[model samples]
Target: MTRIVFLDRDTLPTRPFCFDFPHDYAEYGLTAPDELAARIAGADIVICNKVVFDRAAFAAAPRLKLIALTATGYDNIDLPAAREAGVTVCNVRAYGNESVAEHALMMMLALMRNLPAYMRDVAAGVWQNAPFFCHFGAPVRELHGKTLTLFGRGNIGQTLAGYARAFGMTVLWGERKGAASVREGYTPFGQALAQADVVSLHCPLNAQTRHMIGEAELQMMKAGAVLINVGRGGLADEQAVLAALKYGQLGGAGFDVLGQEPPRNGNPLLARLPNLIVTPHNAWASAEALSRMTDMVEANVRAFVAGTPQNTV
Candidate 1:
């Protein structure tokens, strides 16, 4: 028998299969930091989403053999400590790639089309009273023939590049910084930012990428260029992003993630100007994607139980 405890079940909105597994399984909807020790005392598998299994918690769970991350990003887990503790840490990859890529485009479209301002006009009865054929609150730009700069070339980045291609946009990928050598078509990060009409971020958050897009990077962007971040929130400095929008360094900016989830009420970016569109980090939570996420988790757990590991971090 195996005990599979899922901490922070609220983090994942998907419903999982209730059927019998080969090993005894137990599911806890959610677990808090304080509850980790007691909750994972005898568990064989601990599933989590955004819940930190810190060094203390790892030391507390002696029977734990696996830490199942519900999403692609595993920074929430301390991988080095897990490895040292002989605990396998794994996360699903590209399970929601297409869904998140489309969502990123949706945010970009809203910014380009000024959807929010127009929607406000309709709700305020101004549109109904308008005698003109159209009202111009913001300039709507054509995506065709525009240049799209990709910050990271992972699954999601390539997926978005494909969408840009469909829209008749030119794509340029950003190369790693501080490397003398460069990929054939990819340009240096700095040059890509300077040349792009629209820049999309799809990189993970690491020491090298933390605040990768800051005031200096924003300053290098062409006037009136749009910025999109569908990657980790820590990649961009929120204060700088808000400042850029306020001063028009960026004509428009769209984001699916923020530095903090359910961000503090006083987050600088939340109070920024009209050109920003913020969603509640739902880019990867579509129904179809949720199903795929759960299916992958089941597969990973089954494989681990069968003396194999799949979809690892």
Candidate 2:
């Protein structure tokens, strides 16, 4: 019998699919941080979503053989500790690329079209006494004919680029490290950034990408261009973006994530910048994506019970 414990079940809002593992198994609905060690003590497979698997917790899971991360990123798992403990780590990949890419487009379109702001204005009765057809407190921009530049070439980024092309916008992307291979007729990232009419980010947060777009990078962008981030929030300095927004260096900004989760008080990112559009990090939670993720989880457990492995990270 294999005891499987999934920590932090609240990370996903929708109902999870029923477990259909081939071997004997137990799946806890949700386990908190404090209850982690106790619940996982005799578990052979430990599933986690944003739950810390530090040295202490890993040490306590004496019977743990396989650790399956619910998300693509395995940063929550301590790799060295898992290696010494002989715990195999695996993660689902590319399962939510289209789901996340669509979210990026949503934010971009909402910001450009003054959707949220106009709705607020109308709700406040300001549009009732309009002098003419409309009051121009919020300006709307068109998406077609604008150049869209991306910073990452991973699954989500590539999918977003495809969406940009579908909208009749030219799409370009930057290399992860060195100069990227030049696709025929495609603009290089460096060249594209300097000239992009709109720039959207889709890269992971790492040593090479932390604050990748700071003062210098912002300066390279053409003034009055929009910038969006659906990727990890640490790629751009929040303070720098605020300053740029204040001084008119950046025309508009949209984000589905922030550097800090649940965003701390006085984080300096909450200052009401009218041109900025921010949403809680729910970009990957579409119903279709969650269904696929559940399938991946089942596959992971079945593989482990069969003395095999799948989706190794």
Candidate 3:
């Protein structure tokens, strides 16, 4: 019988997993770094969400053949080590596009209309104490006729563009930064930043994209523009964003990820700014998306065990 170890069970719901073939499987609610080696001992396959699988972990589990990821982002895994060890790694994709895109739109609308500020005012009884029927302490804007610039042209970005157009907003795809010539379908990066009323990022994090939006880029953006980041947190400079918000260079911003998970080292973006909204890295955790992801993971596992792996990366 095949033995499989799920390193971090709490990454998903506590419901039972369905597999067509009979196998020996073990799951832990959470797995600490030191416990990784012992927990995955003697296992042929390992399933993980955010657990870091480094060289040491791979060395500790010589029997491991497949590493099935439950999430799209596999940066946490050491791909080079896995490849050297002849271990197959697979990831699920496009399962969270609809959920993440919808979240991006929601953040855009919330920032555009100053929803957070107004909601806080209402909660503080500022509305009830008002002498007039309506309280308009902050400026509110409409999404219609606004220009939205997207940093990526992937599935999530394309989905968000369609939603933006439905609300009468114009969409512009950003060209690669500092490219000598702009791509045919994309607008010049600097120009797009200057013209956008709302800017959304969907790009992946890598060497070129780390801190892609920093002080200089923030300064180039139009005053009072809203920025939304549904991509990796390291894509934007958190301190720069905080400065922009304080100086009114940016009207507001929304982030679903942070540079550091749990912010154990402390993050500047955690400050309670009236114009900033932060989510607990859950933009892709919607019920429908999670369900789809689970199904895809099962498919990946079954295919790999059948001698033909799919979605390998």
Candidate 4:
């Protein structure tokens, strides 16, 4: 029987796994760095979401044949090490497009309309004690007639574009930064930033894309433009973003990720700001998306066992 071990089952909600083949399955709610090697030893397959599987861990799992990822990102796993160890790695994809797009849209709408500021006023009785019939403090903006620039044209970006279009906003696909030339359907990076009323990022995090947005890029954007990031935390410089928000360089900003998970050390962007919104990286955790991701993980495992691996990364 094939042995399958899920090292960090607590990262995701409880979901049923129905593997067709005979297997010895084991799972733990959470696994720390020191406990990883021993738990995965002698396992033929390993399933995980955020657990790191470095070269040393791969060496310890001598019988590991597959690394099935429940999330779309495979950054936690060392692909080169897995390849050397003959471990086929697969990741689920396109399972959270709607969920993530909706989250991004929600952030954009809330920021544009100054929802947070109004909520605070309501809670503080500022609205109840208003001298006038209505209280209008923060400047509210509408999505219609604004230009939205998207850094990625993948599933989530495309989904967001459709939603933006429905609100009568013009959409622009931004070409990669420092490219020799712009793609057919993409605007040059700098030009996109200058023209955007709102900017959304959906690109993956890698060496080439890390810290892609910083002081220089922020300066290139319109003074009152909104920035939305549902992608990886490392994609933008959080310190620079906080500075931009503080000085009114940016009208507002929204983020669903940070450079560090849990941010145990604290992050500058966490400070209370009327124009800033930060979620605990739950953009892809909607019930529908979680179910779809679970189903995709099962498919990847079954495909790998049948000698026809799919969604390999």
How close to the true structure is residue 110 of candidate 2, measured as C-alpha lDDT? 80
lDDT of 2 by residue, 1-313 (tens): 6677777666755555465554444556577778888888888888778888889988898889998888999998899999999999999888899999999898788877868778888988889979888788877888898888887788998899889888999877665434548766556656777878788888889898888888778888898788888899898988898888889888888888788888976555677767788878888989999888878877887787788898886
Candidate 4 global CA lDDT score: 0.94
On lDDT, the stronger of 1 and 2 is 1
Indicate the worst ten consecutive residues by lDDT in candidate 3: 13-22
- Please, what are the lDDT tens digits per residue for candidate 3 over residues 209-232? 899899999999999999999999
What value does the lDDT take at residue 96 in candidate 2? 94
Q: In candidate 4, what are the lDDT values of residues 160-274, reduced to their tens digit?
A: 9999999999999999988999889999999999999999999999888898899999999999899999988989999999999999999999999999989999998899999
**Model 4: clashing residue pairs?**
none
Total clashing pairs for each candidate: 0, 0, 0, 0
Candidate 2 — which residues are off by over 4 angstroms?
21-33, 176-190
Tens-place lDDT digits, model 1, residues 143-175: 889889998888989999999899999999988
**CA lDDT, every prediction?**
0.84, 0.81, 0.93, 0.94
Provide the RMSD of all predictions against the true structure, rounded to 1 decimal: 1.9, 2.4, 1.2, 1.2
Model 2: how far residue 26 lies from native, Å = 5.2
Question: Which parts of model 1 have CA positions greater than 4 angstroms off?
Answer: 18-20
TM-score of each: 0.93, 0.91, 0.97, 0.97
